[model samples]
Target chain A: MKDTNDWKQICSEYLANVDAALVNATVEEKQQILNDITIHLNERYHELSDEEQTWEHYQQILTDLGPVEDYAELLNEKSPDKKKFQKHRKAFWILLCAGIGCVSVLACSIGFFSHSAIKKARESKRPVVVKTFPAALDRTVDPDTTEITVTFDQPMMNFSWSWVGGGEHFPETTGQPRYDKERTTCTLPVKLKPGHWYWVGINSEKFVYFQTAKHIPAKPYAILFATADKNGNPTEIPIDYIEETKRVNSK
Target chain B: MNFNNWKIQLRKGLLELVVLKLLSSGQFYGYEMVKTLKTIKGFSIREGNIYPILARLKTDKLVVIEQQVSPDGPVRNSYAITEAGRLMLEKMTAHWKDVIETIDTLTAGDTK
Candidate 1:
């Protein structure tokens, strides 16, 4: 007859060994384990036959193991493999974040320098641009069509024109509207609906100077008019690749 | 009932019994087991934990599994108690009751 203390130790050993055994304890072995424990408990219980009642106390402890296997399964949920995966995942994220930070810093540095260069360029290009289109003022037109005339500070090559307003009221015309290897006087024909508003945006491929890095034409790209004013004067409207203003009179 | 020991283990264990009792009632898929167990306080379970023991029980054949298709995907075979499982539950429960009564009677200090 094992003492209650011994029975207690046995139960503890069983719990501790249970996981190891469960790693591969056949049902028979587990059941045998359970039986051995019971026999141990009962043998103790009977030894205290004079106090058979004391044996009853261990019965609960004995029955409880049945349910514990279920609970042990619960604790196993946060398995080591899963934990390792989470650690690897965390490291991967750290590396990814570092990569992103590196790219961001590189981009920011490039942007800062490029912006500085662009600002300097504008400062330098502004004077040259002004010299080319010194008469960057609106010329009023009254009917039939608007005539846009440009004078360059120097002879320019490769002149292009594109119409950007009033839907089909005035379709954009492109493909080297006209080129002047001499006076650098560039002009384009803009056809528009009378009594409608429109803008003719022009672009030239000439570098503001004979030696400049940029060839972008200036803004408000030569405003034109498709609409006739109250006095029949042409009223200019800005247009681009955006939708046309319902050609109030594409006629 | 030691506040910090065996009785605590027993209190925590009551839930396991309820789950086993339920499995004894009929086959229950893991989720189904959880749904049933939730109502009983100690038995509230983390779903993942149930499978390993069920697996062990399966190896033990004290509990057997029956696989069935489910829209949620391949469902684990549900657990059902075996005759040996029934016997075990019966014997353990008998021991559980005997112990409880003995404790009650002894702790009450009423030999009668």
Candidate 2:
């Protein structure tokens, strides 16, 4: 029981691919081509019987239309605008490469003096753990706490991070790690169980993902905490959890 | 040359003529024209291939589009041949007949 919206979505997805392929066509030409194809598809869809108006039939119509790129090729074949666009694109790339060449030469000359400065800065700027959400070794964190955040002493590389330790003691991550706009703090979304102990290593010796923009690795730090039960009472650590931690640390 | 490639080239050349001929009968939307063309032997075409030809024909003033409202659905862009298109089709049809006659005469002995 697919609705008109579903049909429209399918057609839109196909048209988007076709639109991307019509790179050489002018904006007006692309619009005209897309409009014509949309009208064509709409007409064909309406012509179908109630029973034939299924997703399969809708897909078959596109199959009959053939590959989308072929339409781009056919439309671009005799277009005078395509020739003009190609010429402009060629000139644009030539100028872009020349500009990049000049910039590279300038960067190389400046880099001679900047290299030692950067090295000195890197040696002095090893990132430190400035703050943590659970305050490191707290014994009574809320089990319902959904995230753990760590702030750095300096702006770190936003794309790279490592919440290293594994096994049962490692918090179960619910989502990807994200960095604050300043790139100084990173948050890891996690799911914690009541009365369970958790420990996560930020950039261990083997996995040095936590690094500054200059590629200086952060000093290894550990986060350890135990969540309180529903009654707000501390519970004994499970034997299996301790065994798993030992097995993970041994590796 | 490959037979399929030969037919593809032949079909590409004949598409505008065939589309013009279809429009000469009556105003038809893009999809209707494609459906009608697909029924003819040796003229089977991908539905997408017709739009560029139609676009070219419209640009050349050989054919024009009229927006017509359908009772059951959205407004449809229907194509109809112009006076110029008819003149062009007439010449094309005549030339096509001459070519067919020449080919028939050339291959007459092969049929036997």
Candidate 3:
């Protein structure tokens, strides 16, 4: 059962990475690529025998698909006039940077007062996690809890969120993360094992998709909790507590 | 360059041609196209690599995609070659034949 779940987790993570790599594609293009890949994966997975359905075997399938970033490069190459557009955009940025450099020199000559103003604006705009369903560091969350809800202080961009963290400490997500209609509260469907400790991070340094409408990433937050056993008893921490905690913290 | 690397590059270049030729026969879903290609010895391609080519062909008006419902599963994206694709394929095939003939003529005197 655990092996089956692990393979599913691997598949989910692979798809998410592919989605992340397609930064330059249009919405329609990204959707089509993802949809086609999903169908291919599903069909191949179903072809595997029960004994061959392990994570290693699933990873072999992903290997045959090639690296995820290559898809982005391939799409960019195929898109008409992409190279020309990129070249023009590069020149525009270079010119803009030169102009900014001149303005910066002038600002430094005059007081450089805008530095603190810019910092203040950034700090004010940064989003925060207002609340979580089980609340961070809860010791006795019900094992049957099917979802983790995170509420943000400000509205977020739809389809943008990073439920970051991995390994045995991380909860296995069953479905994609989704934002509420208001785009503030995001829910991630998860499967939790009884008496197991789970840690989830929202927006790490690398995977910072939990951004506000203005694209300011939320402050990194960790949700650590342990599920109660069938008897509703808070079970003892598993033997790998220290190692798993270290792994989660490192992320 | 390594022989394997050369073969890989050659295969990559020929993949677009192969996909067009496959679509010329009949419409196929992304998975079906990949499976069929994998059966061809020298023409085998990574499963994920086919989609981008198909997407590019669609963008170039060489192929059209249709949403199809599978009898046992979810909707599938089926691909078929357009008239423009057939014309392009004809030219590619002719060019390929010429290249093969030229190579054969050039290597005809080689003892090895």
Candidate 4:
């Protein structure tokens, strides 16, 4: 006899895999598909005898249904692939715009520094540039906002940052450095917690003017802004950020 | 070209009509519809596969859903053909008869 655990595990895994495979299905379509599958599986299980309740029996039933991708394809075909196509088309345009924006930035930065202030700055060996938002150790920012952008004086060939210290490690950010048309600024969308200190190590290893070998690692930067409370007051701390004295550290 | 491909093509073309005709007689859930269709040769179907077709029919307002509490399990979503579905079936059936008659005339005495 199939134990409850076995049934639950198998059914859930199967459903999860099928759901993951159906990328083109709408929310309602996916829910309806899952509901239908659940009812059918339950009916099938009830019809099976203890002797017949084996992996092989279940495998046969699932196999008869064929790959879930086939169903997705069928659904897409019947529904007139227009929605999925529209989505892809929208994404393509966004990517195209971003690409054009980056190229423009690179060109303008090159033109700006060809013989201008950049050469003088290089000769003096001053901090190449100090530009970013939550501008250099800023102390107050709205917690509800999802991004912190960095702008550089000179166009950078490459730039990356990581959380060195914070309430938690940097949450996964979406998208790459989106440079403005001027190439002087790039916006990075980050997931930040309210009322938490975050330290990020900034690295700009290459620049349009400098070669890779001459490139020096920039100073480690930190964003010290406290996210505001629900009432928009910077004074209050969110419940999640309030460290409990008695809390045990699992690590 | 091939007989199997031709069969599938024919079924694909006739699916909506067949489904409407089936539902015309009575209401059926996704699984029940699959099972009932399976009784016919060359009409094999896997459980839950009828849902997308049913869903499309629902969207086109050709069918309506009625929820029923199952004695053995949770509520089952059953589908019944609407008047619109019946009208579609009648038109499709007449068109199908004409197509069949034309094909018969074109292939008369060709069968061995």
Best by lDDT: 3
* Each candidate's DockQ: 0.04, 0.21, 0.25, 0.13
Q: Candidate 2: where is the Cα deviation over 4 Å?
A: A3-5, A79-251
Chain B TM-score for candidate 1: 0.72
Per-residue lDDT tens digits for candidate 3, residues A1-251, read: 22667666656766776787687765566788889998888898888988887755776787688656457656766466455566787999999999999999899779865777898889788888888887765778999999999999998765567787776778876655666657799989888999887778888878677876556888787777788888888856554654554454443
- lDDT (tens digit, per residue) of candidate 4 on A1-251: 67656576557755765576566666666777787778777777777899888765765556555445445545665354447656887998999999988886897777853445666566554223356666544436666566666555454322222223322534335433343434345566676666655544343222122111133223334333455555665644333433321121110
TM-score of every candidate relative to the true structure: 0.30, 0.51, 0.54, 0.51
lDDT for A48 (candidate 3): 90
lDDT of 2 by residue, A1-251 (tens): 55677587668756765665566666656776788888888778877988887876776777677655456556655555467777888999999999988886888787754656777887677888878887666668999999999999998764457787766778877655766657799989898999888888887877666877556788777777789988998756556655544454334
Better of 1 and 2 by lDDT: 2
Q: Give the TM-score of candidate 4.
A: 0.51
> Number of backbone collisions per candidate, in order?
6, 0, 0, 0
Instruction: Return the top candidate by TM-score.
Output: 3
RMSD to truth, every model? 35.0, 19.6, 13.9, 24.6
Q: lDDT tens string, model 1, A212-250?
A: 113333422433344455577645555441233222112
**Could you tell me which residue pairs clash in candidate 1?**
A27-B60, A56-B99, A73-B49, A74-B49, A196-A226, A196-A227
Candidate topping DockQ: 3
lDDT of each: 0.46, 0.77, 0.78, 0.59
Native contacts present in each candidate (fraction): 0.06, 0.56, 0.62, 0.33
lDDT of 3 by residue, B1-112 (tens): 3454466578777888999999989999999999999999877676788887777778778999999887999888999999999999999999999999989988986746
